[model samples]
Target: MSGMTPDTPARPEILAPAGDTPSFLAALAAGADAVYVGLKHFSARMEAENFGIGELTRLTELAHEEGRRVYVAMNTLIKPGETGAAWRLAARLARRVEPDGLIIQDPGLIDIARQAGFTGALALSTLANVTHPLALEEARRLGASRVILPRELSIDEIRAMGAACPEGLDLELFVQGALCYCVSGRCYWSSYMGGKSGLRGRCVQPCRRVYSELARQGGRPQGKDAPRRKGAPHGRQGEGRPPQGRAPLAKAGGKAGRFFSCRDLELGPLVKTLLDVPHLASWKIEGRKKGPHYVYHTVTAYRLLRDHPGDPAARKTAQDILELALGRPGVKARFLPQSPEEAASPDKQTSSGFLAGKIRITPEGGCELKPHLELLPGDYLRVGVEDERWHATLPVTRRVPKAGTLRLRLAKHATPKAGTPVYLIDRREPELQRLLGEWRKRLDALKEPPAQDTAPPAGGPRLPKPVKPRPRPDMLLTSGLGRGKEEGNRAAGSTPGRRAVPALWLSPRTAELSRTLVGRTAWWLPPVVWPEEEAALSRMIDRLWRQGARHFVCNSPWQRAFFPQRLPEDADLLAGPFCNIANAAALAVLAGQGFAAAFVSPELSRDDALALPAQSPLPLGAVVSGFWPVGISRFGQAALKPNEPFMSPKGEVFWTRRYGGTLWIYPAWPLDLSGQRREMQDAGYSFFARMEETPPQGLPELRREGLFNWNGALL
Candidate 1:
């Protein structure tokens, strides 16, 4: 009864992105099998001009009429207070827009969506961090109908994941789009910088900011607080002078560059390789913030490659079509492990759009450019990188011939240096504009969706049966520290009313170190588990299980698969801080998945973190003290040496360290919530976590002072 024989495989759908009406029409025109859009709120791409519920309802009907599918991205993290609103929105969407699926990041949204009457598919967003092959099973168990694989995965790794995908669940891979410097779901830079949490989709792109490495002596960084030997002379904090002979790293900063901005991922012709991956249901193109021109061209190019993988002529044509898409310089971006191209080039500008020409500032504070390509009326040009603060994008009101000088209106404060490059980011040619106009007219003529009751169904979500709360002691997250020392310390502090429990970081050497009392200690799995490390981690989990290690904390939700399906009755599992558990709904989802307790995201404000336990279905905890990382990446910047402190323009100190298959960028100072421990415990939090990270040698010991986002809102 099936449509295909054993020899011929079904074609994977070409999923396109649409941020506005024009882009949506462009995708439909380009023959995209499906289109994905975001609502005005609760979307990962909050910067995009997302759709309203009524507008999305009309778009979904139009897409359905064209034999295409529409998916809504309600992927932003839900805060404690926003949980009810999120559920109501889901209920409204299920009744009104009726999208084919809802791509989401929060695990807690799963059951709530179902209880809210949403029966459509639920695709796990890449922000969910389903990175390894073993995670596929866990994703399925967590109610993901499809998993969007991370962009950092190699083709071979993707195939492995594809092979392991559970029946009835599918995989989607990014074939073309922007690449992030940090792994998805792991970045906390923007949140740490202020309170714009990337997990909540308000990222201000702190990673794109220019950073300069501090001057290093003997490969050891000397910050302002670099301790001087008892006899050595050093200047006081208020003094501007460096410590005697040693130059201050921050004051004598290295050349500044956009050290973490990554080039966009473009697999123009290379998408053919993905055809061999089984269970790959869709080829996703990422650009909700992009334009109609980009949407059309990219959709067309991927369709061409998919339909004619064996034809060289079609591949050439596809590549040519992608050239017109004014995206950032394309990179394979770790797709080919053997000959992979680096995603970030610190020496090169990582701005999107093609280079048009260089600008020269005039004496009158005006700007002039001799265009390399003929400038058309209505074309948009970006003046410079946003990191420079003066970056601006403007539309061309008049045409300018190639190599002809055209005066650019100045903003007075936008002081772009002479020879600064200008980029042709978008254009509205006559034909495309005409098409968009026609589509807009048709869309406007469509009747608006009928108003519906926005309230959630009576009695709210049919939440999963609550798991009995378990009493957990305060936890200490440590690495390389033997269990003997931990037990010794605990024994010495026996007089404490609530002593900290030791949770050993599960490494390859953990088996050897936890030979005795392994059952008493909880094993903490790494947040990131690369493809190569999965088998070893799984084996280590089994080894530890046999050694009576019944307590475990999974930093990533998918890490649960490393444990055997059959567990002892006394075994306990807790979702770790890196899981980004912010709301009560997410806790219910974790509880349903067998987690005994969870640590609320460290990025949560005191108000958000404290308000959670009352609404939660399981016991809650918090990371009261630790060196929380700003970001984690698979590729390290060659221009900046690892473990050496780098200074942002704002004077924040950051450094990177290679751990396993990934690189983690951490702040110089740790996040200390020791002052808030009593407040947290008083607010129903069962435990507090203190991360014990060994700082690199010679790094300055700045007094730990930050409360993370506890005092302020996590935007």
Candidate 2:
């Protein structure tokens, strides 16, 4: 049975954002059950007023006093030599501030949290981009207490995820906030385009900027043929610019550039559907960058909605508050299923974008957007009907204006029902069907057949055959890292009867090193490289597999595209930190894709991580020790000069501003690895150390006691 009793009220937690003390207090007073905040280093929001040790202690105490929990955000990617410091800091904070949990994004930090003696739980950051059950199980193995589902999942997807997860894992979802067009917490476009690393908490959002381009045959603009327009006089080039007074371009291809902005996500109306998902522990509100008024109004609205779900007046009150917070403009569900016509394009004007779920259109022309609230009469609704997109309005009328909720104007003969969806009367059904058929055919042609080449090319090295293991007990102990020569000698002298540790994780550059230990225990851990080098990685993995290695770790989803034909059937494909497995549904998807194990992101809460293994379908491998790179992106490439550090003129540095050019910094301290091992043991998972560095002086022996204290200071 779970920890909660039958009599305990099934009150879903109200998790709020606190960029600083003021917002923290406001959220707590507004009835937030838990509050999440960031530190000076490793948080995604480089501009938020973050807390230091002193402020964090006070904030934690204050929240605990009000029966609220505090979750400190250390959710950023760690640079080289930075993991040790970040781990120590997490341990120190866990000891001093006694926060309910730590939200993290790096696996190395997860080890630091364990090593520092932090007894608090771990929560995975959304940046982990975890979308599968195997990923969740891996997180559970890594000592996560809770998992924050990605903001892109739909209600049906959430339900399926909840049903698939191992029991006892708690799930959290974002019910409000600005919707990110890039995958939640994994975007590096800002850093790639600008110099700011989103993983390191500094992001110059280039995605929001406007650019000019030449007209193309289709709706898109042609990149090379486009002529450059001079910056507006006295206006910035990439920053906000004054509108050039000009007539809108004709519908035919034109020279104007396409806008790449996405709208915020508002799910105020789908409160009931969200509440129905079992094992859901919290309903979150986004926007640490928003104002106090936005926080107060939005929090109050959701609180009322959750408490009085069935009350019509209460629902209306929530909607009113939401509209006020949203600035009362148009909103749309992003990521949810939509016909091409129903889908909001990059050019369409709206306050929000795609929502993940099913949308149904009523005969009365009123479209009911599920899992998304904040709908009003006179609101223009888009729907995917019969595989084609169409626009309609609530309360069908003979005539309509372009925008806004004006007074209803219906024809004398029209008596539209309240629930029926009213579509524009002029749509041609046959034309839409024909168009959809052609589109499907075009998509089908893109699919490729498997490569016919199985053997290595001439002059290439010969492939090694798989080795059979010697008979022993069914129980196998696999230490994730290989002992150094000296350490191996010491171990050999100390324990003659001990079983040899198998499965050493090798870096990308050390592929040649694996040849020295061929036919022995070994696995490849691919480093994050440029998109152009992905084919090279695929070739390398394929070569390694044929040469005897079967286990592997991929750093990101983009790398998955390279292995389309070469994914090993028997190999243990451990989803790396970049996979960001935060929920059971994500884990399920990974399992379907043939992953044998996975690494949980450090950003998850301890409770969420613990639940992951129970809810997942594969073996969990906890990140016990290592300096896992937190910010892995092509953005770092942009800053590289022939001999200079990669820096961005438009980008802001995360922690230290004065330093320029490809700035790399460490976390405040190391994670407590021992603590995580114990936690994973308790959760029924076999733990392994991901040692990116030599085990500290006392650490190797401490592995036996399962108690090690590594103190490195924070940035």
Taken over the whole model, the C-alpha lDDT of each candidate is: 0.80, 0.48
Name the regions of candidate 1 deviating beyond 4 angstroms: 1-9, 217-249, 451-459, 463-471, 486-496, 701-704
Estimate the TM-score for candidate 1.
Answer: 0.92
The C-alpha local distance difference test score for the whole of candidate 1 amounts to 0.80
Clashes of each: 0, 89
TM-score, predicted candidate 2 vs. hidden true structure: 0.49
TM-scores for every candidate against the unseen true structure:
0.92, 0.49
Q: lDDT by residue for model 1 over 499-582, one digit each (tens)?
A: 656677788765566467677777889888888789888888888888888889999888888776766679899899989998
lDDT of 2 at 536: 56
RMSD of each: 4.7, 23.6
